[model samples]
Target: MSEQRTVPETETETDTETPEVVAPEVVAPEAADAAAAGLPAPPGGSGRSRRVLAAVARWTAAVLVFGGVGAGTAAGITAMERTEVPGLATESDGRWEYPRLSLPALPQGSPRPFTDGNEGEIHHADLRALLLPAPAGAAVDPKANGGWTTRDAFLSAYGKEDRPPLARALDDSTLRHIAVRAWTMPDGTRSSVHLLRFGSVGYAEEFKDALIASEGGGVVPDILPEGAAGAKMETYGDDIDVPDTRPYIYQEPKPYGPEQIRWAYIQAGDTLAVVRQSRKGEAAHVPFQQTVTLQNQLLG
Candidate 1:
């Protein structure tokens, strides 16, 4: 608990009607008796004195009841010296005036009210409902008359006769699954996500086109023959510098990740991904040739 400081200490002296002691001449005891019996004050004191004292006591009691008059007659401050914060020469309006603080009021129609930064972080979601970020810049979908079912139709959209080897695709029912697989950086600061699409050739081509478009690149048919896993690993690895990563766990907390990468590679299936790196993390590659061997599985 905080301790309270005492208000300024003041020394006050006062004249309390000191009764005058009179030398009573040798008067008859009978006369003094008659005066005392007839009045509240005896012969030596006047009845007025008793009445005045009583009045003073009542007045003092009333003023002190709440708070006494400050630094004045009623204050009972009879002193030889000074006081703190100068006595008011004029009647105090009795209202305490505080310093005026200048600040800017908020905009008229602005939605959110005044809030601390930490409080703002909490309420940001609600405020964002009124003001949202621009929509994601996604690629415009290509024009197609109806659902594409044939290998040639969808393949044509990616590219016609001039399409890279990526244009050709083979469907596989051996392991049909759509999954999200990710590769993490060594320091665990980043992850590259792939939506692994493993199925027939038609679907795989579409997925592949989408993936390449996202990467802002087209497949290289001349360098790596069509549908060849080993050729792709070498070609893509060289193009992408796959040699520069540390050891990365294919799966997180192990619910079937490493094997999935193997399956994705061997199935000739396509994986759609957007790569993001952790600003703060760690990777490596290869039994050199053996590492190339593993990455080649995707070419299947």
Candidate 2:
């Protein structure tokens, strides 16, 4: 074998460079803390924070809903206890005395307050019960009969002209209430009555002046129609001898001598009573008698 190798002179091959193996480097605790402080939170932690914020928002909404419900309940209770007027009832002579009023009978139905009944057919809050010891019939003229709460309605009912001036003259604010009734009698006689309440006697007097001016061209000396035969107006006040009284009466003669139309106004305390009657072609004392009867009732 030694003699064969020396003769052939064969060579062995070897690498000049080789790669080195290295393990992965571990992260330092200080580097991890620095990243947490300067950078945004991880996805998992961000999701958990969102869940907590949603829970707080839901809790706040529930609190507001309960608070609103409580406030509404209290307001509803207060509204139910309100009264129309203060000190509206009183006692006298071992009996309760209260404001009581009535309306005259009509051809079809009785006159009732615009505000009436517990549920009130008209203005519910404006309604009040009249503590009357007994029911009384309203004083009325058979010719004109109806009821309304406002002057506009009154003018419309009678088909009067020049409504604006008259409406202003009879201002609704000046009167507490008004009731009207009218009808044509079986014998062709026409009549009407108005029951008005004023804040005071002085106010009633002022209203009376305006009323006459509106209906009969100005209150002074009375205006007469062009062809009137001889219109006469008779007023009776202290002359009647009733206790604490001032009354107004006027008789307007028609163009024809036989026809008679009369108007009367009376005051009892804060109330003003009025009547208008037209006798077609005859004379009767019924209108005056009716006036006297009403005057007596008011005084009583």
Candidate 3:
């Protein structure tokens, strides 16, 4: 009986020592928290350990919320940029359909409304809608104008068989497209603007040189009738104060009639334009004014 009681006491002591050894592991988490807080671990560090765990949870949640918000904002911006809007997106063929351009107001009133085609004439099968350039606040009346592509047709309308300068300008090597617009002035006289869009700038320059050389003394005739009289052509160099101004040729109506008319031709980029301003009374510099304004529009 004494030997059995001594064995039971030894077993009890072993069990007690085992718990003491394992007790330190339970407190290990508390000790780590104290160290992280820059404080010496206390004998009982459970409170500090709970505080550290709570702080870590809050920081992690805050990081996730902010990160998610930032990512969502970035995604929204990307979507907006990719969205298609008129004038913002290009076609598959790489053409940007620009918005209707604002033009300068006419002298009589606001510009005439836009039209699909001019009256009394037809566009070529390949001819697209006219994309005219005009100064801001000025108005354009496309319906009031008519255009023809063939050289012979153009001459027939103008009542002229041939003019050397204009014929050279119509050569296929230099000319790519020829269109004209005829608008009625406020005074009932008719005015016309010609658009000669060339295939290349080199061709345009060549056409300009030919026209300038043909009209001796830098004069452009308002009308090139076979038997015209009193044709007064004026050549302007640096004296004309205009933006992107090139050498300009102005021709007053021949015979010095009561009807006032002025004609001019100027080049902007790949287009060489002819502008004729006509009225029943005294002559005005309307053609020159339009030329300068149109050039500014082109530059823009």
Candidate 4:
């Protein structure tokens, strides 16, 4: 097991830097009316609130733009309050409401994995903090509720036949730690996220390669999840473009027993993330894609 510590809540500091404000083209008549009515204005028009929103919008755009440039760029973006942003504020598109995510504080003098002076690309923060938090209204699994878990617990996700080989591989891969989080949504969609950290980038890559390799030109992993016998490559249209990370997404073909499963493997630096979602009848693609994308962003 890896060392465990309490992850401190990130403190919000007011940005003192002044932003170069751009004038809006259209000022809604409702802005003044809304203000006079003691309600907030629509997310436009010229005012202190609009300026703040504009600044946040620009900052969010920069984060998304820089995300593809290199590793660690997305770390700063996850700290922003999602509800404060306009489009992201609501879950109207079948997206779950996840809490504001922030990278855990590193030990003094420790450089970030992709930053200068850190060649190993090792995460210096607690693994537990890297696991995505359960979304609103989710019934969290008490067994794997964002904490360090044993190797056996991690391997249990695989079929019984595949678990032995995976266990052996994990033993030889210089695996350092494993952290997990799991929850069931109101609609019966069960989701779990597992993060495996290795001693170095080479070991992590080797493990990921071994796990994903298949006999034919198949995108599915060699070892399927507990109940899934087979899966086919699934495209959510929008791909996550974070640097130093790759995602392999697949969905269990129809005629599955009971529930359909969608899973993805995210190989990021010295860590590999496995995200799995299963639902009876059918698992919606939008939420699965949204979940995987957010998790990949955090790992980026």
- Which candidate wins on lDDT? 4
Candidates in order have lDDT scores of 0.29, 0.45, 0.48, 0.78
Write the residue-wise lDDT of candidate 3 on 93-188 in tens digits.
211122344433333532222223322112122222342433223334565344545655454434343454466556743566777655453435
Worst 10 residues of 4 by lDDT: 1-10
lDDT of 2 by residue, 14-48 (tens): 44242232323333345456677996434344556
Q: Which regions in candidate 2 have their CA more than 4 angstroms from the true location?
A: 1-149, 153-163, 212-231, 235-241, 257-259
The count of residue-pair clashes in candidate 4 stands at 0
Model 2 residue 139 distance off true place after TM-score fit, in angstroms: 14
- Model 1, residue 160: what's the lDDT? 37
Q: What ordering of candidates by lDDT runs from best to worst? A: 4, 3, 2, 1
Q: Per-residue alpha-carbon lDDT of model 1 for 1-300, expressed as tens digits?
A: 001111233444445553333332343355567777895433454567656656666666656643533435445435422443235223322111212222223355432222333321111112112111111221212331111233443233232344435333324222233222223322332222222333333454454443333222434322211121122122333322222121112211123222212111221323222222222211122212222223322221
Better of 2 and 3 by lDDT: 3
Model 3 misplacement above 4 A: 1-148, 157-161, 214-247, 253-255, 286-292
Provide the clashing-pair count of each candidate structure.
Answer: 15, 12, 6, 0
lDDT score for residue 74 of model 3? 75
Question: Which residue pairs overlap in candidate 3's backbone?
Answer: 103-138, 104-137, 104-138, 104-139, 105-137, 105-138
Which stretches in model 1 have alpha-carbon errors above 4 Å? 1-176, 181-186, 192-195, 213-295
- What count of clashes does model 1 give? 15
Count backbone overlaps in model 2: 12
